[model samples]
Target: MGKEFRNQLMKVQKQFPQIIKEVRGKGLLNAVELNSKALSPISAYDVCLKLKDRGILAKPTHDTIIRLTPPLSMSSEDLQEAPKALHALLEHDLPEMKKQKPETVSGTVPNVCDRCGRNLYG
Candidate 1:
């Protein structure tokens, strides 16, 4: 990962404690999560847009996670462009996240044994 991006992300983490729960990833493939399930995807999207405006394009994943996947071969100068963008998103866009209610999806994912005809749970 680029040093500049890491530096910027660290900056955001320092500034926003409640909003940014955790950050994980290697190289330029990183994710920042929100503290609550209710504030994930929307906040992530806003972060992406802020990065876009600063010419550091990124995307969101798992609804509540912001993915910072820049090219693996990014330069120091190129990497430095993420801090202000991220800060802007944290400051201005995070408060608009809607409440996330609980729901369930039906249909079990069958886990079959390689040599058995039965599903793992049954």
Candidate 2:
């Protein structure tokens, strides 16, 4: 099941070489490394946010890698949807996201808390 899921994800990577740097993993634990240069102002967290909006929950690691660990009980059919959603996002939404400007921060631009968006440096 893990191999099948990784293969499906590899297909998505092939479809978007500019965005996906590599796809690697063992068992149900996998990571998608995105081209940081290609993503620019958009981080992996931003991509995860989009994925979340599409009903997928993924985590960002090292700012450019997305960690995917589906539950063990997930059926192969349901698991297949992950790659499809990723493909759709890269194909349709990414282009639009690229066009948008990064959010501008006023003043000193302190680092904010990820979960609550509070000013971490304050």
Candidate 3:
């Protein structure tokens, strides 16, 4: 898993040098940030879809960051393919995400869980 993630991360770094500011983390947990609003959740969603299409699953957190948490034992090829997929997604989707108005962007999680909309203040 570590090797796979590393390979993919390196590929992404190489492919999108202008946008990728830095990548951090280890094992199956990793994150890469872009230079601009590309880090936004809306853009991450499109990137996530691109990852999904490549058989690598990922998601965004905080609506301004994308995180990669593949199985701890994914193969090298799978890892290598992730960035390629994400690149394609970013090229097409990032612009659209940037075009959206700030008000149009939705929150990542609801204020409360569906089953417990109330706060847990006891």
Candidate 4:
């Protein structure tokens, strides 16, 4: 199941080479590294917020890597949803994010828990 999830994510990386730097992990723990240069002012936290809106919860680390740690009991169908949501966001939403002014983009680091949506840094 982990391999399948990683493979699916790899396909998304292939589709958006400019945005995704790499998709790598072992077992159910994975990370998608974004090309910060390509993303410009749009940080990984921004991407996480968009992913949350799509019903996918991902955590951003190092401002460029988004971590994926799905539950062990998650079905293949549930696992597939992450990559699908990522692909859709990259395809439709990224362009608009790129067009926004840097001042308009959020610069604060993410403080919310990716799993439960609770404010962790407060």
TM-score of every model versus the real structure: 0.61, 0.83, 0.60, 0.82
| Tens-place lDDT digits, model 3, residues 91-120 | 775667557636333555456533436654
Model 2 misplacement above 4 A: 103-122
For candidate 4, lDDT tens digit of each residue in 11-30?
99999999899999999999
Model 4: how far is 26 from its true place, Å? 0.7
Q: Per lDDT, what order, best first?
A: 4, 2, 1, 3
lDDT of each: 0.64, 0.87, 0.64, 0.89
Q: What digit string (tens of lDDT, one per residue) describes model 2 on residues 1-122?
A: 99999999999988899889999999999999999878876778888988988888999986699999999999989999889889988888887887795744545544885666878777
Error of model 4, residue 35, in angstroms: 0.5
lDDT of 3: 0.64
What lDDT score goes with residue 65 in model 4?
A: 98
Error of 2 at 28 (Å): 0.4
Worst 10 residues of 4 by lDDT: 101-110
- Winner on lDDT (2 vs 3): 2
- Residue 38, candidate 3: Cα error in Å is 5.3
- Write candidate 1's Cα lDDT for 52-98 as tens digits: 77677777663467777877676776666666677776676555433
Give the candidate number with the greatest TM-score: 2
What clash count goes with each model?
A: 4, 0, 1, 0
Q: Is candidate 1 or candidate 3 better by TM-score?
A: 1
**Candidate 3 runs further than 4 Å off:** 1-4, 38-42, 92-122
